[model samples]
Target chain A: MNKMQQRLLHPSKATRQDRFGKTISLICIGFIMILTVSIIGFIAIHGLATFFENHVSVMQFIFSSNWNPGQLGKNGQPQVGAFAMIVASFAVTLLAAILATPFAIAVALYMTELAPKRGAKMLQPVIELLVGIPSVVYGFIGLVVIVPAIRSVFGGTGFGILAGSIVLFVMILPTITSLTIDSLQQVPDHYRKASLALGATKWQTIYKVILRAALPGILTAIVFGMARAFGEALAVQMVIGNAALTPTSLTSPTATLTSQLTSQMGDTIMGTLPNNALWSLALVLLIMSVIFNLLIKVVGKRGEMKK
Target chain B: MTTNETVITTKDVRLYYGEHEALHGINLDFQKSQITALIGPSGCGKSTYLRCLNRMNDLIHDVTITGSFKIDGHDIYRPQQDVVSLRKKVGMVFQQPNPFPFSVYDNVAYGLRVQGIKDKKIISQKVEESLKQAAVWDEVKDDLTKNALSFSGGQQQRICIARLLAVKPDVILLDEPTSALDPISSAKIEEMLLQIKDQYTIIIVTHSMQQASRISDKTAFMLNGDLVEYGDTKKIFLNPEQEATSDYLNGKFG
Candidate 1:
């Protein structure tokens, strides 16, 4: 009788255990959100303070083609202009994304649609391995292999904007292609069937139905790949032929924001104008990354709504 | 639209999916401008035979077919035959409502666009005519640009039928087109089928005895992948000759 009464009072131990399980899940989610908020808050506070404290005009900071913030007026104070770095950085990233996107899409299509199943299974792992390699190694290879080859072809020293773009392109190809394949594969088979059933040829079905249906996903993949390429510093610095000015042509040396930071950070005084400029550039890069990430998220959300 | 006009004839048709036989040497004739119903339980191969009409099974892996099937005197399975052209002549509606993820108007115009008909006027006219024929024009006329996925299940099924009708195919295949709809929707589809039969030779696969008896002029009953009995719909339902057919229709056994 005593044991029966104890069982009734305890009921099941599972009730408390389930509550504990749910609590753990909430805690994990809260930790991630807190971490993201802390990082964003830190960047905004520190980065925004530098821009406001300098008393420099935002228009000159953005539109000026030269960044020489160290040499001052008749007083000989430091003056720096950041326009060259911003323009060169965007040019390099856009060129690389444009060069790589088509090849990535083609490779993804071949892997998912054209290759036999057995061959595809064998190749997928090897292609995915490209994403795991360190960026520094790719930089070294770009310095040795890609730079000299371009110099020979262009008939000059090849460490320039074109060389840097080529290296970034090669680095981002695998990311775009793999994501593209995933999106293409996610398109419903019914769309393909309906297209074919309407007397459209195989190529027609892919072009008209399958690709169109997955267009948002493909666009998101390209945006993510471009974001990765844009942020790549080590590889671009190794081959960009940093000349501290905006590039005039593919053969001319140029310095992106990352190269500028790498060049001026440790060698210069900690609180100098160049150092402050590096922080500003970092903030700009952060803003670009957030914007692109938001685009990817919105596109993904749209894909879900369609499904 | 003569009653004696024949649109498709299958002679000793046999179909296999990999190592398993799904249809075993079934002979049947589908009349032009009339509705023919193929009724059977699940796995009886009625759907498989419907797919055979347009060579849809060719899309599947490890599917083998051995038979003589003709649509307007053209052997569909012959090496020289083009499956695309054959399919254009014989449109199909699936068991599930599968309107393309497009605008309601675009769903009806998909067939014409694929056939390279670019005149907007012709497309709009045909879209309206097809939707009216499917009895969905009144519901969707105000929202032609809205996505087809926004429609109700019954509306989507009707939109699919409208899609099939826009191609002006000589024959249309329905694989339980209304099975996914509610009772009211199913009745609407049945009424539409009766109206469209005069212009298109229609072959329907159904499990409902009442639907078969109500709309079909000729009925074929299949069991265990074999055609057990086929005759006038009235005879098949009221006076089936084969014991298996009688037992199946009487609900004695599947």
Candidate 2:
């Protein structure tokens, strides 16, 4: 009777606990929303301020390659076109994605599908170790080793789009590979069995069935890799020569939006037109990454739908 | 049923997953153009036996199988045997309806394409014929472009059969093909199997005793990694020579 009577007292306690849980979760979600909204809102306002303060046309900023920020006597008229930076950023990111995707897929398939249990266990930690190594270390390696190798091979200053692409490729390899492994591992074993039962070879089963089934996940991985490549500043800036010009060849030096903003942020005075332009660049970078993130969601959601 | 020719014969077959032996010296034979239903309790090696027909069990790690599995006098388990070609002769359908997440046409065309049959007309004709043979052609012919996964469970299972049939395998192994389906779908599959048994050797692993009695010409009862009984389905169901087989059929104990 005592235990039963005590059980009667549990409803209110459970309700209170439920309320607390709900409140905490709501607060956490609200906090994230507020932070993201404030950050994007601030960037948008400052980015548009460049056009508002200096009579700089948005079209010119996006299209014109000339980017000489005027000082004294030129007043607010700053040559702030970032078209070259946009092209360079895209070229570097695309090149990195192209370089990393096939290797990532191959490594992922070998690790998750083909490797023995013990070998895979040993290799997994090594791959994760690669991921844990700071991006700056990769940058250092690129500047020291990759740049020189490029110079010896391709015969150029070597601190160019290709160097940046290689460094970004190495930096994003672990990210893409791990994500691909995760996606490949998620496919049910039944898919492989079905394909193999149809007399398809193991490799055929992997590429035709397993890879097709895991496509959306792999796409999400590549998008994440590309986003990282696009948003990367420190590593790419260090290896790239940071010349504010469009790259005509792989060996030609070019500056990405990230590189330009990172380089000029400290040089510009507070509330100056150049400072607003930098903010505008930051906004562009943010927009690019957010678009990729959205693409990830779209791809993941489609995968879930298929499942 | 026809000429008493053994399409599949296994001699002193033993399968081990690492240290544990799952099949203990299994010796079984199946006839050409007949249905052989494998009946057993769970984990009794019936599914494992079915998989051994196409060497599907080879996909698992730490599986050490010492056995001579021969199909039509060709040693299937021999190292020299090409698994791809062997599987082309022995297709398999899993317990669940595992249609690839493509259109119905593409799902049926998968095996042919894997064999490098690239002519669009050949693929289209084979896909249509296989779908018709699987008895789902009328329902899906209007929507060959529709996603295979969008079909009902039973229809998806039939599509998988069509996929296997597209390659024209000599033997089709079905592992509990109708277990996940409704009774009507199960009946449809049973009827379809009965019709197709004239052309292809059928090996099915089933949990249902009634299904075994209804569809199979020969039934093999496996009990704890051993072949407890293997005989004509009627005799095995009604007057089994083994006590364990009768006990299981009588629902006394598994």
Candidate 3:
């Protein structure tokens, strides 16, 4: 058909709807992109000078892990060391994630598959309530309860990386369990039924088919959980004892970048250096979180595409 | 015909999904070494009846079935009955191609593996024999290691058949196995069904009147969850005893 005839036959209303939908969606996406760029620009503008300053070497900052630097020469003042803080942060986060994973999966499984209707109805609200509780309360509990318990067992030093990890583990449990339950629930009912119908036992059906199919989603949940654990701040500070020295064990006094930044921000001598370091630490933390989230999304999307 | 050779029989069976009754006290006999086709419209309970033969309907929550369903002269609905063995003896193929996401050989070997038959030689032999019986060995033999989902729609359906056959079930239940396939695929499935009828009792539920006439030795016409007529396939197709059955066969109504 000729162009004019085709235009008349097709009608402009359909094309107009498609164009309008595209324009509206583009506007929404553009708004979010602009907001992100603006925030990143602000952080980079304030912190770009630190990257160039000879006062702090990049290798010394990352590799040596000695965070404290002097306003004068090495002979004039003692430099604050950060090796302990970095190691303590990673050690505590790893411990928390490992301790919480199995319990989270069991809670998720019970919530999704085995719990009775009334029990699920009651447990769901309680689990969701855990999410809304303020982080400070969990920290307070760690101070009053977990610290003392550890002290009683490990000679009464109530503050350390272990205490901080226990607190953070409790704080992030709800997030991991809820995400796991969502992933398990999304597995197709037919896969379960088909497995069961093939004369496989109930546990076999879940392990061989349900869990196999839901692996990507479960892995995503774990990565997100680890990301949350590594970035937690106020709660970690309260239980970690905030010592500037490196911790040799879970019970040893130490500090995280967050706690160090908070403590040093108040000192008059530390000034903008501590604040600048905090921003840099935040950039590192942000990059790590994004990497993990991207990993989860990529794996989950691949699984969905295969299906 | 020997009465002792029957594969599956139901006596005044009643099935209810919640308060609503689906099957209204139906009695039927599924014979050995023959093809029995149940033809009816959607929601006429044909598929439900087929699931009942293998006790698959028991999986539905809040469903209650009364009366006796027996296979090899044993009551399948008995409280003490072992559903695992029952399912192994009476395998089912679904309306859609529901092949497991695995290699073609693995799909065929799924049943054997579930039964704890771990010998590598036995599994390989059974997988090949089952694929051959389903008439898909030659087409898939070269690519047995490839994912079953890579196959065409017809080939996937046949792979499902091969999977079920590897279980060595005495009775095979098919629910509109070819309704999802094209005409050529449907014809291939019909021919394969005819070839395998001698080794196993085959009960197929179909919507197509022509398929029922072509492949079935015995045909049962059903409407609204009740059997209207049942007899030899040739007699039912050409001269049905009931007016409703004839009307359905003649394309007057379904």
Candidate 4:
């Protein structure tokens, strides 16, 4: 073969660089996969230890509200029930999502349809700034302002599911709003024009056509916001009162899985039941996050299929 | 069929998009129950002018319009003229077959439902009649609940026409409704327009000269934001008054 033909057919400097680039990317991905798998595996092993090694039945761990892991209950079973925390987590996440969704949709509509220039130039940056603010700052604000506000209104220590939901509402508002704006923008402009051309009023077109077309995407956005609210640690912990009790009312003290885990993780001995219980909580959080991710994927796939 | 009865009259209509004038003082009168074709090259403001008739251009920001637009001798641009009702009297179909990502039944009944007609029986009856009027009933009769976007482009376009017909507007403005379709679909739409011409005043913006001559009762040729020629389709095609009209018709230049 000629020199040029041989260079084209065989490994050259460019080919070496290509292989090197591929190897580097592959190594990076491999490292990430290993890190992720090991993290999940570590959490899983320790989390299952509560039921396996400690002999805590899954039903007692999940359904029993008596969560005193350091001692045995009257029934001779370990009191490691996560029912309250699970309920509180769901309550806070759902309340926050419900409180935030309408506001997010309104802001997104204002940005995408009503006043795009003002939204892009003014509101977009403000929302991005809200997202950039550290979660600790949000926690601090919740602790000082929201707690006292609730105390004055509801006659409590001001630390409860209400305060936590309010804090999470603020925290996840920007996330939901930005994602909602993206979904609203994804709706084809032709839909708007078609609706308007049919003699539909602007409000009718927005509600009937634009919002309907963006339903799945908006649902995905709300789910993502719920995920953020569910997994949040520091902010929710500060406002949620850190009480290991069942929430009876909106203004009552409660403990979410994340808040409980964060509060108890540092205090427990390394190999104790308390520590294993915290790991179990972490496992719940991990599973919930996976479920959230799957929900987003399913929603996105359903939206595409409808299209 | 030249008629003395004018349905829509626009005298000296000018439109500007952020200081860039798109339509320059266009004056035209559309007759009642007649198909008028506006033929032009791209960016000649044909679609822009059509949008003005129904005040659809009001949706765009930084758009300044100056002129008098009257429908049935009532000034439609008046401050008290209620754009919503004006649009009900004047409907538009776009170049793309834009059906709401909904069922065919919902898509056709959308206009009626917008007017707050909540009776299901009336809505279904109107939807069926509109679909049949638009010549798409036979194809979509079995799949009324199927999503309109799931259909082929041609069927989707027909569904859009049905949507427009469901509103029962006196004037129908189509902005190159067949430009995005194949020849057979275009022919179908042309035939459907001809069938409905006696019921509504139809104004179409088209690039195909053959389409204009084949379907339009009167053809108006526009160039560079100016109405260059306006007359009978046969006269404009066979014996032209302006040099530019013949030139464009012969494919000499756009």
- The CA lDDT of each predicted structure is 0.85, 0.90, 0.80, 0.93
Question: Could you give candidate 2's per-residue lDDT for residues A115-205 as a string of tens digits?
Answer: 8476478778988898888888888999999999998999878888999999999888888999999999999988888898999998898
Q: For residues B4-43, what per-residue lDDT tens digits would candidate 3 score against the true structure?
A: 3677889887789999989887888888889999998789
Model 2, which residues run further than 4 Å from truth? A1-11, A72-76, A116-119
Q: What is the C-alpha lDDT profile of model 4 across B46-69, one tens digit per residue?
A: 999999999999988899999899
TM per prediction: 0.94, 0.94, 0.89, 0.97
lDDT of 4 by residue, A78-125 (tens): 789999999999999999999999999999999999889877888999
The residue pairs that clash in candidate 4, if any, are none
Q: After superposition, how far is residue A77 of candidate 4 from its true place, in Å?
A: 2.0
Compose the digit string of candidate 3's lDDT tens values, residues A54-139: 35555555555455653533654224335666788788878888888888888888877777476578778988898888878888
Cα lDDT for residue B94, candidate 1: 90
**Candidate 4 chain A lowest-lDDT run of ten:** A60-69
User: What are the iRMS values of all candidates?
Assistant: 1.1, 0.8, 1.7, 0.7
lDDT of 3 at A110: 80
Candidate 1 residue-wise lDDT, A1-307, digit = tens: 7998988888478988998999999999999999989887776765554467765566766776556766564445334556778888888888988998899888777777667486478767867788888888888999999899998998667888898888889888888888888898998877877878888888777777777777888989889888998788888889988777778888777888888777667765655555666777788888989989999999988877765
What DockQ values do the models have? 0.68, 0.84, 0.43, 0.86
What TM-score does chain B get in every candidate? 0.98, 0.98, 0.97, 0.98
Per-residue lDDT of B201-244 in model 2, one digit per residue for the tens? 89999999899999999999999999988999999998999999
Q: Give the distance in Å from residue B167's predicted Cα in candidate 3 to where it truly belongs.
A: 2.2
